[model samples]
Target: MRSMEVDMIRTLETDKAPKPLSAYAQGIEIPPGHRVVHVSGQVGVTLDGQIPADPARQHELAWENALAVLAAAGMDHTHIVDAHCYITERSHLGIYRATRDRFLKGHRPAATLLIVAGLADERLVVEVDLVAAAGAAGPAT
Candidate 1:
């Protein structure tokens, strides 16, 4: 059978649950037979190890790095079941949401965002970590 884009994971959105402030869902359900991947914290640091001074740029790049790790695990943003993000500044919430929504396309996964005082590197403005699941996923190398 030819493969196409499918909602492999289930997003939990319900009126019974508290209304979300943004596009994130209340939760997500990963079905049996699917495998999960836990991605480490991906910061805004570039491949060349340069962290941009601009918070928006940092937020955007952090998501980009997360997407890269997902792809490496043979998954895409659609496979993401949860996203845990941290931003240094509370004012960067708008920028973080914009960047995250862009990377996630139209898929709404479970998410949690935290505003922190700082990170391991003071130059870093944002960090994104993800939990993704896919079908018959076994690349446990």
Candidate 2:
């Protein structure tokens, strides 16, 4: 198929689960053509740059940020094909899964969550990165 120029990539703050809880978007979309995105590691950094002290809170932040990155790239959880999650506390795995599911809403992509020794930032409790793809809708311009 012919590819078109993609434009208008924007991030969305999904549900009101938490604000600035993570550095991610609820969703994203690129216009005109197919899109490929590489979301970077997201941590618990609120809009004000404050890191949540609680690991659970930070984990949510990381996922949120990661989602934001995907939105900026014009993709959402539905478009995600691969993902890597880094966590400091393994016990919080359940919490992470639950919070992540809140956004997924059934769009389960290929993913890997890892329990790490620690993150680069001391305040960060978790980090995530992922890749996504979206087919260009409509005809090429």
Candidate 3:
């Protein structure tokens, strides 16, 4: 197996959405010799794998999951360079922004928000995909 080293990866969200499901940013900073982590779409679920019903709550869960993945790999929000968010309810954009602000604080990554028909899970109101880089300075713009 091949192993790699990383310096730092940060995760951030505005009041817009919850933290991402991975230790990736809504965007990333990368240095040379780095590997980018591509996280799959994550729904709002508890650590034990309990899914939430509320659209806003589900967003929170998805974000938390993303962060957990990043931390496990020695990364955080700051390392995220790109993000994809899927929302079932178009009106949830406001909630997303609020939550994002709460989580990201200031750092905003390059992101695309989509209003989808549905997600993998029905109760899941939102799902997020993230891109994180390790062994680099930061994400590439």
Candidate 4:
């Protein structure tokens, strides 16, 4: 079963708006013929399946987990078009922002941050999910 190839993707940037704070484009323009990949929410569990105690550590781990999902789909951070972040406490915003900025470096994709009452696990301080696009489609089932 041969797979279909996707078209190239373009990152949209304009000086009209403030540059993205991290390693994501302000917007990603998917060509007419492109497919989207949705990565599910990822928590901050470590390789040993243990959630960290510090909120900042958890935030970093969550981003790593989400990026791992994109990588599994043969996409890198540059392919990300959007990201959604969830945090249990408002006080963690500063930490979250700093951690995200470090992880993204320069790519700033469309992003949304939400303060929630709690997460699926009480030990989890942050969770992140992403949507990405690549230049190759998947094989048909």
Using all chains and alpha carbons, the TM-scores for the candidates as numbered come to 0.89, 0.68, 0.72, 0.77
- Arrange candidates, best TM-score first: 1, 4, 3, 2
Q: What is the lDDT for 44 in model 1?
A: 91
Q: Best candidate per TM-score, number?
A: 1
Could you tell me how far off, in angstroms, the CA of residue 66 lies in candidate 3 after the best superposition? 0.6
> For candidate 4, lDDT tens digit of each residue in 14-49?
777787664555666677655688999999999899
Clashes of 3: 49
Tens digit per residue, CA lDDT, model 2, 1-141: 112222334444444544433333444444446556788777788879998787778767777888887776656677765567888888888877777777676654556778989888876887878887776662222
Question: Tens-digit lDDT track for model 3 on 26-86?
Answer: 4334556777888888778897888866778888888878877777667777666677788
lDDT score, candidate 3: 0.70
lDDT of each: 0.84, 0.67, 0.70, 0.78
Alpha-carbon runs more than 4 Å astray in model 4: 1-27, 137-141
Colliding residue pairs in candidate 2? 21-61, 22-61, 22-65, 23-64, 23-65, 24-64, 24-65, 24-68, 25-67, 25-68
- Candidate 1, run of 10 with poorest lDDT: 1-10
Q: Candidate 4 vs. truth: CA RMSD?
A: 6.5
